[model samples]
Target: MKSILATILSIALFGGFNDIATVNELKNRAKKAYNSGDYEKALGHYIMLTDSLGVKDENITLNLANTYYKLNDTTAAINNYSNVLSSKDRSIKTVAHQQLGIINNKNKKFEEALSHFKESLKADPTNEESRYNYELLKKILEEQKKQQDQNKDQQNKDQNKDQQKNKDQEQNKDQEQNKDKQNEDQQQEDQKNKEGEQKDEKEKGEQEKKKEQGEEDEQKKEQKPEEQEGKPEEEKPANQDPSFSEKLKEMNISEEKAKMILEAMKNNEIQYYQQNKRKAKKKKDPDKPDW
Candidate 1:
């Protein structure tokens, strides 16, 4: 630790009176060479300032890191930047920390890079680049977690929807089968009623035929010439027949006189006769009205 401190102090307080001016001149030349894309020439001049002149300035260290960075020596660049970050100079601390983090990230040392970035933020919280990098890493982690959760939710929802669809299909199938059975039952009932109506009609026709035959037998048994003659003369009429009265009885009239009157009214001459009899009754004296 003492040798390290002595080495660091030797680099800080160097040889001659014009030592800083000479180191500054070399640094300017190095910058011009680096700007002109002569990375090897710039690296040689920067190494002369840090090693030979013992001028371990933060700017010179940064230049050395830049030189190593251009040479694709990421580990050397990261080490130099880390040394700049560990210095007592508070003015360049934030920039040094941020650069160290970037180099470490370029080297694929993510945890070390993260540690450096956190130190950078602690040094200067308002550093836009460091803050952005920190927040970006945080956002990437959060997005990964959210993507995992979304995939899980989508899988669960798909499973539930499939289950619901299966249940609905089963219910629909059952309902369709029930409806088909109901239709078949209705058809069977209708066929039964139709057969019953046909059988009733057939029974009614048979009864009618039997009644007609019985009536013919009764007519054959009762046929005496005198009995037939007794049913005639007054029971029938000259222009009308007794069958008219039987036809009137079949019409469901209860009064015999009303049935005869209705039958007489159907004939034009009999209607004229009834009207004349009513007029004659009206013309007769109440006390002397003939029966």
Candidate 2:
């Protein structure tokens, strides 16, 4: 660090013209080289003036920037122009800002270029070129901003339309789903009702069957006295019941058929009695004769 400081101090303190004649001669040669369009030779002379001679001259710095710009060394030109910005001479500062604006404009930096142009006009307001550049760039930037806003508005409109369409589609889908669900529920309820109806019919049929059996039992009880009438009080026939004729009447037999059935039953009784009488006659007395 100390070495760097010492080197800087050495150049600043001692690297200058010891006499006026040598300095004037170098200045004439640099000017002549620049006027002849020999930028390389002019650049060498300018570097000698600023770096080797350590002349703190703003004009030398500005000229160096011009030469670098002519050589298409934009980085070096910008550095030199920035260095001249702090100059006390308004003409030099205005020229620096103008050059910087031109460089930035070529690189498509509209805002920065316009700012530099405005600064250039502030330093030298009577310069018509700076005024024109500032007005033109400002108008261009305003038009660009307006176009961007219009495009943004159109884009928002399109997005809103798409969103509304999607919302409507979703609503329709939900409505369709609800309709299908209702249909399914109704079908299930109908099936359940049909099953309930079938069960009720089956129960009704069973109940009617039980009722008919009860009525038949009551009818049989009511006919019991009729079947008992006209029977012998002493004894009943062995092979025939008194209820037999009633059974035949209940079978829808004609009156003639009922009499025939009664006659058959009476004949069976007579045969049974004769058989018992013959058995009695065959029995021998204990005190009577034996064969």
Candidate 3:
């Protein structure tokens, strides 16, 4: 009976020690996997350990958050990191806040990231990485705002230049139109002057022709009376005289002798008158003085 009790006590003690050894082995395997950059294997082992040991284990929770962060799983990393913040260990809480800050900064949540960094500094003021990141984000945001303002100013300057160019072109067009109108008016004035000169010349030529016709008419009228004064008078019949017949009866001559004597007398008278008229025309008057 004594041998059987001893055997039962040894079995119970060995079982307890074996259970502790299995838990330690599991922890060692998980850390080895993480160091080797096998995040998937580390994640699996950490999940199993947490499930068996309970979720309230701070060290297990921090390791799980780090593994998720390495895998780029922001949601799981944030959840596990948030759980680590409730740990009583000051060092663990500080590291948890710093991790949350990095995740929020990567997502461009500036205000949330700054809040996490501020909390991390409050827990442990000597964290240089958090301080440096916070200052760098502030400077980047300021530079982006300045660049936007410069682009807007350049756009306004280009608009003004275009407006001025259009105004100058319109002014030049108006000036050209005015110059063309002035040239047209000058041409019209020159044509009018030329037409007036032509009309004056035509009227002067007509007046000169009429004056020449009136002078010709006056010369014809003056010559007509002078031509009629130069004509000779017609002679009367000698037989018709009564004095010649009376003389013939008084002489008591024969009819044939009387006719012969009358013919002789007529011939003598004609010859005497012609001789006297020639002497009068040929002889210059003795009473007239020589000039």
Candidate 3 TM-score over all chains jointly: 0.45
Q: Largest TM-score belongs to which candidate?
A: 2
Give the lDDT of residue 208 in candidate 3: 79
For lDDT, the strongest prediction is: 2
Q: Model 2 off-target regions past 4 Å?
A: 1-32, 158-166, 212-291
lDDT of 1 by residue, 120-194 (tens): 888888888988877776676578779999999999999999999999999999999999999999999999999
Clashing pairs in model 1, backbone N/Cα/C closer than 3 A: none
- lDDT measured at residue 132 in model 3 versus the true structure, 0 to 100: 74
**What's each prediction's TM-score?**
0.43, 0.62, 0.45
lDDT against the true structure, per candidate, is 0.74, 0.80, 0.74
Rate residue 98 of model 3 by lDDT: 86
Worst 10 residues of 3 by lDDT: 226-235
Q: Please state the error at residue 143 of candidate 2 in Å.
A: 3.2
Give the per-residue lDDT digits (tens) of candidate 2, residues 1-291.
Answer: 343344335435645454445455556667787889977777777776677667777888998998899888999999999999878899999999989999999999999999999999989998788888889989999999999999999999999989999999999999999999999999999999999999999999999999999998888778745244423344443236777667767988865776677678777876776676577568688898896
- The RMSD (Cα, Å) of candidate 2 is 15.3
Total clashing pairs for each candidate: 0, 0, 0
